[model samples]
Target: MTAEPNFVLDLTLALGTSAMGGYIAHRLKQPALLGYLLTGLIIGPFGFGLQTDVEQIQALAEVGIAFLLFALGVEFSLTELKRVRAIALQGSVLQIGLTTLLVASVSLLSGSAQTPLQGIFLGLVLSLSSTAVVLKTLTERGETSTVHGQVMLGLLIAQDLALGLMLALLPVLNQPDAVGLALGLALLKILGFLAGAIALGRWVVPRLIQHIAATESSELFLLTVVALCLGVAWVTSKLGLSIAMGAFVAGLMISEIDYADQALGKILPLRDTFACLFFASIGMLIDPTLILNNLSTILELVALIMVGKALVILPIVLGFGYSLNTAVKTSFGLNQIGEFSFVLALGGLEMGLITEQRYTLLLGTIAISLMLTPLWIALAPRVVDGLHRLPMLKDILNRAEEPKLLSVPSDLSDHVIVAGYGRVGEVLVNVLLSRGYSVLVVDNSETAVQRLRNRHVPLVPIPFVYGDADNELVLEKTRLETAKALAITLPDPATTRLVLQRALAKAPHLDIIARSHTNEEIDVLTQLGAREVVQPEFEAALELGSHLLNTLGEPPFDIQAVLTRIRDDRYRTIRPVAQVGEA
Candidate 1:
């Protein structure tokens, strides 16, 4: 092996381009992957080609996909799938098949460079927007448990499995025998690979990780975890399967481990960097000029991608016993192009199943489709409402709807507000509700609020207003005058301050419990009139400590519950300091 270079230019370009993409994407409410794709587009063969070190950079970028999907596999579980089986399988299959038929037909008619079979591949790809991107967006916004989000995750998982299968099929699609043989071999390899990985995870990796954790070298721990994933992936690839399968299996194997969350947290930042690179690489594949010249194709493709797919999916979801509106929204969510399309296209090219022109067309189409998902999702309600009123869709809408009668009891007293509804604050809500305390939920979540509203659950069921909790008006609407106290259950300190300030002014006597994202937030929230502070990772750490102590045969056996009790901590008395300035 050669010695490592003092400075890697390609690495520099990857980092630089990724940073640029990330910053820009952050500003645009888009995924960094989009930026990465743009980076690749800017510096790709068409753009700068800047070939001083293209090969090494491309290789580095590819690892982003592996690491990203590996982590993604951990996020998904068969258990979760079973829990959401109704949406995951039914919604996904409906979305994929419908999107495929519509997109393929339109592509063939629109004179796309791709063949009909390639169009099918393109549609399948289009149906799979990046789960990594969407999930991160949802998580950051604290909407994972939201109905549409859950539906989105279910559909994404289906797409992921499809992408994996596409990987198996793409490299052998032209050869019928190879297709059957390779796919069969791939399936068997994946199954065995998963079994082997689980065995290692259940019996070997945990002990190894425990030993490594004891060493307390984070660098070492991260390296070891990375090694495990890469090692397993390599073994699978060597066994005649795609490395992508190995990556996903690696994540699944460790998903159930005791330190799985910790392991994931440590690797997450690094995973994001490479993931951005992966998206940039995808962007590099697009030809902006070609896209500009192909406006008609793009328009037709986008319409087919969204309209035809939605038409097919809405009916299927309705058939499966969901209401038309819910089905329509669900269909809208799946109407984007995914990262899988790029992978599939590459696979086709490698297998001589597709031409370069067709691959480019697919890439551009997928990119355009993906670019539209957030916008589309944002506009779903209006579109669904309009569609419901349509003469054609109205009957379908009436046939089976998700359920209506938002009995929003208008008679609720103002109460303290908590933004996030995660586990940490669920207990708080329970305590408040059980004690006959009327608390107004200031959550922006569409589904959670909808659930609480549907049940007419506490305080005569006031509507749970939907929007960013950090906004001043969201707090204002919560009726701080009637509010007895306020709680900022969100982890972000800056956001906490926005809520805390409004609370102090509106109801000075209000007892506020604010969540902290950092240690500094403890001091900051104290200054901001937060009567108490909660940190997500801090809570998790306490749990881990208790878990560790019990595992080591400590005297007390009730470690977990004991850790959950915050009575010992001066959480109530922790007066928030000024939102800014020094201690």
Candidate 2:
């Protein structure tokens, strides 16, 4: 029998170590993933050997990939992906081509006995990086909607596709005939898988999820979703495809289903908890001792691959008539190898297509490149700015307005100010905007900022000067002096009172409206200088209580629409508090 006590001990230690690492990384303002990777490095066989059950952990890690890809596929539809086909496909292809050429040239110069096929495999490995790493970094920084974020996500999608193909065709290419047949067969196989999944998910899965959700137990919902992910994984593997490929296919099939969304929501609570284990486990596979002994060669390959790959990607994007900003941003994003690299390296090792040494080098190099991406992106603005200053290249970037010091009066009569673009603020902004009053918004959510920017809303473009509304800086941005009225739509009563106090001191004559969820809170804010205190629940109850007196069949209080209306405001805060500043 398996050692149950050992299993329990291992899990407890893994969870504790991983949690500590995540907390530490969260405090450091870096991706929690890096902390998990570091944790694995410390606890792996090389360090504490706490994860003694390597086989079991590997199996779980494999399951995590299947589930993760399934979720990605569910979210990434073909239609949405097609919009950025230019950036994703061409960029990924270029990244691969130039990276391979550079790596092969370096290998040959270094006197490695690697042949053409080995060179191609090595090139493939060098071209890929840590998907989990780069994506987490992008996500943590709140850059997903930026032009660079979209391009980065698209290329990652393409990388996933390329990885699927490599997983399919690489092993089969051991023979020349198999090489010719592999592409067609793999394509046909993928098509069949896609067709079958679409039919099953649309027709059959919704009924199953509704039945599960009807029970209203969150645990059952989560369990059923995991089963679906793993069941699809097992089914796909039986068809001679990778489990991840199956997971992705299953994800795409369920993209349009209502049950899919519900089931997925339940499946993804603390997803990265297990997913971090997946990344950290991969890092554990790397024996840093071997990496240390060959530090010179590793550093040389790292520089060669990064610089050479960037050179290859630069001209291609520039040739596409992307402004220097777009071109440079595109290059910086692709400069790092990512998730696909790990997939390709491990697959190559499994197929015996690459030697163990090459595999280690490839993994270590990709890891380093991924770790460097955040710094690269952080420094990109200055680099692009410097490049933009050149006349020949200057005309390429999209024009953005140069910000000027907006001098408005410190206090005003009958003016408007919105705080926190939440549900109530959304409706208030729309109603106020329809009246054509000059509306000033203060919020810290980056997502909200991008959304408002996309709509070209007539509001001050800067993020909230301070994270907390209680701060003097944020109140200053709202120009307490220039406003005739200020509406505090944020949920927190303490914050509303704090803003009211600041407003009274700064713009004593301004009318203040504070939104509160409870009557007691509203009473407190009114005492603090708020001219009016509106409770959303009470407002809804009043409206419904009125409509109930007349329409007879009006739908019960629509909490969702009320919430949506609140979001429709100019500051309808797209910038969530979770994803704070610039990515």
Candidate 3:
């Protein structure tokens, strides 16, 4: 007997293929998103014809978008949202307005749109930048806590909110007379939903999390968090909003609570899985024939999106009083068209505002733009640096404002510079302070800086410098040249290396103690000019050996001598030696 087609088999094949594609992309040092999209392009009906059940895969892909939005919401904190609120709100509005006008004008001039409605729709589609790509790159580069990073995140948050409004308006754009009334009603409904969610978040959600936590059941806690995410998503759909909108609201609700991190941890796996599918499904929609035929059009639109958006955004960021370095970086980071553009394209297709061919063009442009984001970000800093070297541009580039240089006593000198304020740094600070040594603490975490500021310790002089130690400006602000010693305790190996190089360049004579995770890292850090490198593993091993020796009634003097010898040999005696031929 012949078997019927099975959707389960197709689903497994799609996911499995996406995994291989993602792995390949990772190996190439490219974003897994590119691989996921390529997977869809290959296995989709247009290529190998593996995923014949496209509709089912697309349905599951919707879940991926919801989870992506939900995770974004969880990461969105009120403090960060508020920090750049003015710039985020105003800059988003300005960027959207300017981009729409520019693109709509171009669309009209180029005959891309048959009607004003279509032109407006097309313009809005190009206005947004991809939050997923920008955030992922920023986090990977460890720039999420930097000045430009904050600005980029703030603008993305603003754009996400703007996207919801655009989605609300798209359905009614075809109705000229009913447009205002429909928008008003929609806004009212959204505001009402938000108010209710805020009330619930302020009371019910936190209590629910508390009760769930009290159960001491991690499974129950995770289950409840998922329920809350889906429940809100359903409620939003019922209220005539997108599921993505609901998921974002759900995230905002959980973000304000003590369990925000826990909720994020629980939802991340599902979010990532679904997000991969979402990106891959986007890939599935690409028509290879259409792209080959419209290569010129695709290239033209990609140039417009990559170049036009950056030109528009650079001035907006500059006008916000940000340094040119930050402005250029922010603009470059946002040069790509976003995933939300696909949503708008779909809505436009549903409303008959755009043809299938145009939709194909939009998808191709967005995919190409996203593919270029990482490269653009990598080159942005160097580009800005080059521009600053030009005689005329140098003055203009440096003219923009820098982070407020905090005040320290003029006589502050001979202090120890602590490069991180995490657990290890904190302990070191306490020990240094108790000995009457002045400590200059530098950290990139805003929360840590704020906490240190608010801490009420009368007569204690802990000068906290709020910036990334990796930045030369931030390092210079610490007056490392005058410091007696430097401690590098940052968790990231690359960042530690960067800070070490920068610090040693400025103060070659500074006594530097560094932390390493492995024997290789210990050697590498010492070679980088660290006066002493402490590997946690060998230290733990020594402690354990000392304890064992004491239990065996070995002499205390002998134990001290053994530990001292191990330290003198740089943990050589305790570490297993590699075979001479081993790599």
TM-score of each: 0.66, 0.66, 0.81
C-alpha root-mean-square deviation, each candidate: 9.2, 10.4, 5.0
Quick one: best TM-score, which candidate? 3
Q: Candidate 2: misplaced stretches above 4 Å? A: 1-3, 74-79, 172-174, 237-242, 259-261, 314-330, 339-343, 346-353, 385-583
Candidate 3: worst 10 consecutive residues by lDDT?
398-407
Off by over 4 Å in 1: 1-7, 24-34, 73-81, 104-127, 139-145, 170-183, 235-245, 310-333, 349-355, 377-422, 433-583
Of candidates 3 and 1, the better by TM-score: 3
The prediction achieving the highest lDDT against the true structure is 3
Q: lDDT tens string, model 3, 472-537? A: 677778888899999988765556787898799998999999978556677788889999988877
Clashes of each: 19, 21, 0
TM-score of 3: 0.81
Query: What is candidate 1's local distance difference test score?
Result: 0.65
Residue 431 CA error for candidate 3 (Å)?
5.7
The predicted structure with the larger lDDT, 1 or 2, is 2
